[model samples]
Target: MPDLLVEHHGVQVLVCSADGATIATEQDALDHLVGAAFQGAELVAVPAGRFDDRFYDLSSGVAGAILQKLANYRVRLAVVGDISHHMGTGTALRDLVREANRGRDIWFVTDLNELTTRLAPRP
Candidate 1:
């Protein structure tokens, strides 16, 4: 089971999972992540260790479901923690994600501070 943490910033973040096991499937992962989002969470931090670039494509139903949920709620999504091991290495995606890291939309961050800073109310 994934542990979801509701923070003072009005964003509920899911960190680590029960049994330290990586979720077995994309379907289950999306269900867990989206459920957490519906819980009044504005942002979600899922470790990259659990999912790969296979999770990045919208063509994948599981990924599509997550993107749809993020768009529907206008919530910012952040997957914190190192994904390099899970994804090997790639600056292109890193740049792509960095560009999307902030806006009125979703963000995939590698650091917790970056996530908190992004979630802050803008003036």
Candidate 2:
């Protein structure tokens, strides 16, 4: 499915529907960041399952690399879906998810609604 453009807190966000695509590598992350920019979107919401399993592995550094790329491009990222399973495996991974969710640049949310709420302008 095609990406849906939505507005939140006056920001344009590209919400990617599950398309059977896996964002497993740095290249995939880069491609999405560029695509988001091309679509005039400041943020991109991707389903968690779209990411490769290695992304949740801290030693693999996949998640960190992808996040770095997004940050470099000044593109916000929202990873939506259930990640409780991945989080259960390690404290490091869980810590990473927690830290990312606490920041504005990257967020790990349970659903699209939560993503939108997190992106909403705060008073």
Q: Per-model C-alpha lDDT, please?
A: 0.59, 0.83
CA RMSD per model (angstroms): 4.0, 1.3
Clashes of each: 0, 0
Model 2 spans with C-alpha error above 4 angstroms: none
lDDT by residue for model 2 (1-123), tens: 887888887888888878757888889887765565568888888888889999989899998898888888888888889988887776998888888888888888999888878877788
Candidate 1 lDDT by residue in tens digits, 1-123: 756676736656655453443533545555666566667666666666655455654344555555665566565666766655533454555554666664546667677787777666778
Assess candidate 1 and give its lDDT: 0.59
TM-score of 2: 0.92
Q: After superposition, how far is residue 85 of candidate 1 from its true place, in Å?
A: 5.0
Q: CA lDDT of 88 in candidate 2?
A: 79
Best by the lDDT measure:
2
